[model samples]
Target chain A: MSSIAKKKGFGASLWDYLTTVDHKKIAILYLAAGGLFFVIGGIEAMLIRIQLAKPDNDFVSAGLFNEIITMHGTTMIFLAAMPLLFAFMNAVMPLQIGARDVAFPFLNALGFWLFLFGGLFLNLSWFMGGAPDAGWTSYASLSLASEGHGVDFYALGLQVSGAGTYIAGINFLVTIINMRAPGMTYMRMPLFTWTTFVASALILFAFPPLTVGLFFLIFDRMFGGNFFDHTMGGNTIIWEHLFWIFGHPEVYILILPAFGIFSEIFSLFSRKRLFGYSSMVFATVLIGFLGFMVWAHHMFTVGLGPTANAIFSVATMAIAVPTGMKIFNWLLTIWGGSIKVTVPMLYALGFIPSFVAGGVTGIMQAAAPLDYQLHDSYFIVAHFHYVIVGGVVLAILAAVHLYWPLMFNQMLSEKLGKWTFWFFFIGFHCTFFIQHFLGLMGMPRRVFTFGADQGWDTFNLISSLGAILMAIGVIILVVNVIITIVKNEKVGNDPWGDGRTLEWAIPQPIPFYNFKQTPLVRGLDTFWIEKQEGNKEGMTYAEPLSDIHMPNGSIIPLVMSFGLFVASFGALYNGEKDWAIPVLVLGLAITFASMAIRSIKDDHGFHVHKEDILKNEGGNK
Target chain B: MSHDAHVYSKSQTEYEYTRRVRREAMRGQVTTFAIMIFLTLIAFSAVAAGFSEYFIVPILLLLAAIQVVLQLYYFMHMSEKNHGMAAFFLYSGAILGFTLFLTFLTIVWWN
Candidate 1:
């Protein structure tokens, strides 16, 4: 019995993960996949820096350079950062709310597989012909003019992946809304779960526009439609409208979770309850609400005229108020409390100043006239990297360190973590901060190279050097991860000793079924409150010991996603191949067959009896 | 099981009564669906006939807005639970999205 319960061999573990429908395991899959993409995107960044290291460099061809930059942006934002945040949310949120699993476990597995296969299909373009060369936005006129299958790949890949994201978002919404533990009121939920709820709602609303836009693009390119062909009585500006409507909220979708992470860190390390919790929640929802209103701020340079510009500009500025409320709340969260300078706290502290700089620049761009000069310039690039890297990426790194023990029962070495933070932080500043000045000096973005006499050479070199430093920092982080996993040093619940959320209330390795009995959430920071009241168990259960129902793991989701993967290839080759139609039909049949089977089958899940629970009580501990 | 059978039947009867009440609550949704179908037909007809294209577009858009409300309230089950707050959030997003589209169209096309 102990041997069966102990660690299995490699193949056994592999099989377990391959068929696992557990949300936590799915989170690990997202992390692993997202981490791979992050590294690939980072390498692309290095290539970009190398090409621009000196003025008039010709290391990479212009077309190829465009492909690299396009993939870098698209991959980082969609594939790396968002999924990594999803990883954290999946790993923690259910535990926070004291749910055994997400609302739809099968759908969760399908979501991960769809994302994986879609990303694979997109990157396969590199070997098949070429990756997407149009900028990540793939603005209509330019994309329509571009040759080869690059834009086609972008549309199809994003459509598949975007559908997956939409599914995951809806799942989070239903899970958070309906599956909360007894006494876990909306107001009493942890900030991260709250942000996940709001961000998921944003995703639910934001992604449909992108889906519609991608459909239009696909039809125009592949199916002989003229939605974007201006000469054929089609309007190109419609594409811009559709993309930004999705694009603007996409930014908030990425950053709001970063805000949630910092909120948790501030309260935890400072040993203080989050100040003005309700107001912080209010601000988050408000920012998400206002996010959809300001899409046209990106169109100031596209000449939407004064009335459109002024309305969007004002609406864009209004977002700053809610965001400002959050900043003050964080500062107050740390005020007059015992502060600890952990590696995560360092990133949180660094994020405040860095993200403020990014936020202010965003406001500056909100001024319509000012943005006319800044649009498509290095300044816009600098502003977003500060927000994305300085804000979101930093949060990912911090959460990796902070939540490592919670997720994997191992702690990343603090010594190495601090080293990673400094190098990456300094490198980030060096790389992006100078680009702001470069933009001010009349440098346009998305250019392969610049002329030497333009006085941009030195800054470009410095930026390239900075990129190398950031790479080193990432290498150190990888080393830390390897070391921690190999050592496998165990940590107990509340590993930080000041964790304020329910996620930290569970012991390490976090049993396949989290929370033998659901915890009764009392108030904001319920776990923290329980700790203050001297509860060593770290929770107060709402229910007595009883049999717990658990859904059986299934491989059907993988088969379902694989069917779509096959159909995507068929769709891609529809006109080119003789067998394409048959393949498409077969693939779709597989998917529908699986769906039919799932719908008709009754899966009354088995229960872990009370005696089994007693037997396993101290196993994880 | 033997002793409780009578009580179980009584509870089942009560559940059937509640189910009937729930079905009655869905009468509003039947009307909503009918109205949606009617509006969609009108939109297709106006666009197809090409009559007063300018005025027809606005009328069509207004009807489309009504259909959106019907879908939200009826199909999405938003009417049953926390209806006020859910409606507030959904409508706010819709209004903002519509405003963005209109503002862009006015500035870029009308101007």
Candidate 2:
């Protein structure tokens, strides 16, 4: 009954988070869960390096190594990188557009819980059975042959998580399209919001094919279906086409938002308006469109014939045009402006050359004839890591440093952050750069070990050393996070002096309902415009204060996600166990009954009265 | 956040104009409905008439396409002004789906 700050017991706080429908709280949930998976994936990476450190050392068995590598790729891409980016998106996008919450708050919570449970179910594979040893791509040819319950876990877990991702994607699309505040036109939105919009659209178009492919995989593996079995009048290549159709855009889905993050960092630290803003937006969209055109490039070596390969080859190389434009736009953004080498700005500067290096190698491989030579080689490995780590991971780190204050009202230690960056940046190149040459020297990727006499020994040793350095960097980051949380030093709004978006304009400890009065977005960099015009309040309100209607918290989303989690286990054990059918039925029944209850009950939310708002304004200020 | 609705009374001319517009819209809807029914009957008769297989198939497909457009424009109100976003996304998805199918046909199946 009270709106003032009241510290509750740990149990109450735990329950609050469990049922919370607030976007900010959901964002925190995503951050914590995604961060946990990042560490898990990092450990997997370290294990791989340790195994590969010295030739034929046998730190891990070959089968376990396969599982480690597969889990590393799967966990990093699906669980760690995408969800971390989603954390920033969920935390910042609505605020950037000046919306109180996403268009669907309950669905937002459901999305996070679904993602968490899905990740948990996938990780549980390590204990229940051997992890999925087929590569992260899990091509039908390999996955269908793999014994044990590992691939089953991969298919069912991804199905659960992918649904969550699809839902989140749709939620973001609707929120961006329909929920902008008055005067916040599409053109006036921040780069992060623009990128989130494009990425969500990519998700909308991309996830369906993944869903289809995973279903075929599940059916082929668990049921007696032969969708990929050649003896049964089914072709395996269909899986490749379906997977890459989803997979290729999935990379764009990750990196475009990374581009958006760096765009913000570059402009913010340089204290300049983004140069060629329209062109940057254009390039982001162009890249997203072209993303769909180049899925065939990943299949060039699959023997689709010279004509198909040539057509796809050109399409793949053409993506560089927009990407090159983006690189130059960042350069121009930093040109002649007051560039501060903050941790984030440092990452942005590091990103340009690193991503370009990755892009060049990518173009080299896009030539079908050349890709035939590089296929399944560590050179291919180097090319992707250079982009993924050098691009997406770097952006994730920079955004963490950049947005930490906005999210938590406390700043991460700048010195420690810079330390983490250097180790990570150096270790990233050191780890993967040599692998390109190792690949050329005939070291195939995903191998458990190589002979000491094969001339790859020294390079593999160096790469493993570099992986250690990267792990140290991550460890330092974890330490930094723990320290920041423990200190909990409060900071005021616009902690970054040069904030440009609406997110930075709100008072510290942003209200559960963001923006008590809807903000009037005049133009790009709306906050900067307000500050320059000597507005002490740091925003121009479009409307007078009024009672704010907020959705009530509910446990339905958690229960809904948990039901799927339970059902996944049942589905995973379908033919193998007697209890599986009942469990599956019970789980579906739980989900459906809860859904029916939700539809039947009318839970109109309460309003925060105008008097309550005014009372809080004094304390917040 | 007051939820009170304000009621407005139309002038006599305004009321007449609104009524005329609604009547015209209704007339247009009814005509479209009749045309759709006539097209369906033609399709059924053509099938019932036992035309050559090739001729019948193409005609049926063409008629079905026409029906889809008519249903979308008239019944679904896709012709309305505010449906631009919906239309854009729908068309984009359709094009993407077509492209995927074309790719599969050429590379995966045709070979």
Candidate 3:
């Protein structure tokens, strides 16, 4: 929370990050961890492509391939995409609404550490035994059949991380609901804030089902409770129902924020107010609501009967209406005003056509009978990749380019950015576009290899080549990030001059307490409104400057998360190890002790007095 | 804007406004308690009476739900202003949970 500039040693910086409760700093933590996992998942993806590149290739055994694929999906969805999106939400949403900080900054730090520990625990499966081979969904029948501790890692790790995700969701919900500065009404909130709100709600409702499902997985595997054991009168399909019930909304939980990022980009870069802004809000919430009703669509091939299938199919397709509303609104937003094709905007432009293709395929799969053909095929694979990659990944990348200055006070190389986008975009279409055809040509997904005589070799090679191209693009992005960080050339507020929101209002090197005085958010694009009126300050204060009360940083969150990480190992070896029970008890004691200390401690936190503030301000501004 | 001066003696009108609001709140709580007790008694009698299991089940569920709503609105004070966000989330969670339950009942229970 230090506003004063200082240079510190590496160890001091490390210690600061480890204990910091600041939202902006926490965003950096998420970005660093999620980026590492993203690279891990990417390597896993490349391995998968390589194994399938040529017919009967022995790059990886079938068993190892299953492990790789399972980890890739689980890591990308849980560890990478969601956290990256969270990074943006943490970094920008509070600023956008003109809040000094999030509602519960300590809880925010707790969420990050919990996620990090959980992800570490899960990935440790590679050395502990083998990784989960039952796929990311961890369907009960397959996961129960899995012999090693892989599925245990998947279930327990997700449980821990999912709890963190749920906590973060609640934190954001409370922040957005209560912490808006004077006059920042729900209707007046930026689309990103609105989308974060809806997405948090989605997380609130969606994650419980996953928790229940994972608990079932854990009980069946570790405790021998037979929640999904068919012999014990438990039905495996019940797991599918529960998983998809959570799983479907989880998709929206990822995409809606991505949509928010794109919406911000379209409006800001195009120099226009977001078109049909209310409808866009409506669509976001509508998408979240509709997201729940369509879980059964994923289960269409699971034999839920014709009536169930028909209902779910139609409900799933009905979602296209609100989604179509969003797409058209974006098209109309950039229709007339001004269009600047910056890196983020270029990605936004690329997104429309790519996501539409994905949506079209999604509708195709929504048709139950058609899904009968496409389900578990490479086509389904292509369809989801389009949506997740083209929609969410594009948005994350675009936002990184867009908000880098805001987060780090440095700009990424835009010249290299276009090169990254084209390579990734072209490579994305090349890899997945052919997979759709492969699915249509009777090629199944999750296959380690195919017979060369089947005539799938050419398409497989082409897709592999495309994957390599995509890898090159990601590597370039890494290089670009390195160059930018090394250069660290400082940039000012509203780095893009056509800044539209309150996030753009603050000056370079954002103050520890974001707004020195809580800004009066008059309307949508509040800072833009002030800037239009020639207010160089880009804001009008709701109140006079006063002493600011701020929370002190604590290391309890890391310790608490580490407690769970230790306990997970104990749980993993339940009856097999004699020390397991004692270990579990020890871990629980540590966690509870930390909690007790947090509760009993009387740290009221210090405030910056007006004299010190005025002194700091006297010579600065 | 100092806290010490802002906490200085309040005017008579401000005290009267606080008194009126408290009285209204008290009355609302009393009425809600009476209604909740009545709903619970009805739930018990539905089980006490000899009726079809289906009839008793729906009746008990309905009555229980009504009581829960009362508890949230009155006892928990979610009905009060500034709890709009709370109400939205409560209803949203309820709708999603109920939807999941119904889907499970329709698809899973049948098999």
On residues A1-621, what C-alpha lDDT tens digit does candidate 2 reach at each position? 123568999999899999998888788888899899999999999998888888887899999999999999999999999999999999999999999899999899989988998999999999997899999999998999999999998999999899999999999999999999889998998999999999999999999999999999988987788999989999999999999999999999999999999999999999999989999999999999999999988888788999999989999999999999998999999999998999999999999999999999999999999898999999999999999999999999999999999888899999999999999999999999999999999999999999988988889989999998898888899999999999998887888799988999988778888887999989999999999999989899988788888899999999998998998888889898999989998888888888898899999988888888887773243
- Cα lDDT, all candidates: 0.88, 0.91, 0.91
Give one digit per residue, the lDDT tens place, for model 3 in A102-148: 99999999999999999999999999989999988888999999998
**For candidate 2, what is the DockQ-based docking class?**
acceptable
Docking class of 1: incorrect
Which prediction has more favorable lDDT, 1 or 3? Answer: 3
RMSD to native, candidate 2? 1.6
- Across residues B8-64, which tens digit of lDDT does each residue of candidate 2 receive? 999999999999988987887899899999999999999999999999999999999
Q: Any runs in candidate 1 off by more than 4 Å, and if so which? A: A1-4, B1-89, B108-111
Error in Å for residue A430 of model 2: 0.4
Predicted candidate 1 versus true structure: per-residue lDDT over B25-51, tens digit per residue:
778778888888888899898889888
Error of 1 at B93 (Å): 4.9
Among all windows of ten consecutive residues in candidate 2 chain A, which has the lowest summed lDDT? A612-621
Task: Give each prediction's DockQ, rounded to 2 decimals.
Answer: 0.22, 0.47, 0.43
Write the residue-wise lDDT of candidate 1 on A1-621 in tens digits.
121167789998887788888889999999999999999999999999999999989999999999999999999988999899999999999998989899999889888888887888888889988999999999999888889888888888888888789889989988998889999999998899999998999998899889999999988887788998879988898899889999999999999999999999999999998999999999999999899989988888887778778988999999999999999999998899799999999999999999999999999999998998898899999999999999999999999998888888778999999999999999999999999998898889999999999999999899899998899999999999999989977776677888888898886657777887888988889888898999989899887787778888887888888888788777777788888778878888888898898889987777777778777776455
Q: Using TM-score as the measure, name the better of candidate 1 and candidate 3.
A: 3
State every prediction's TM-score relative to the real structure: 0.92, 0.98, 0.97
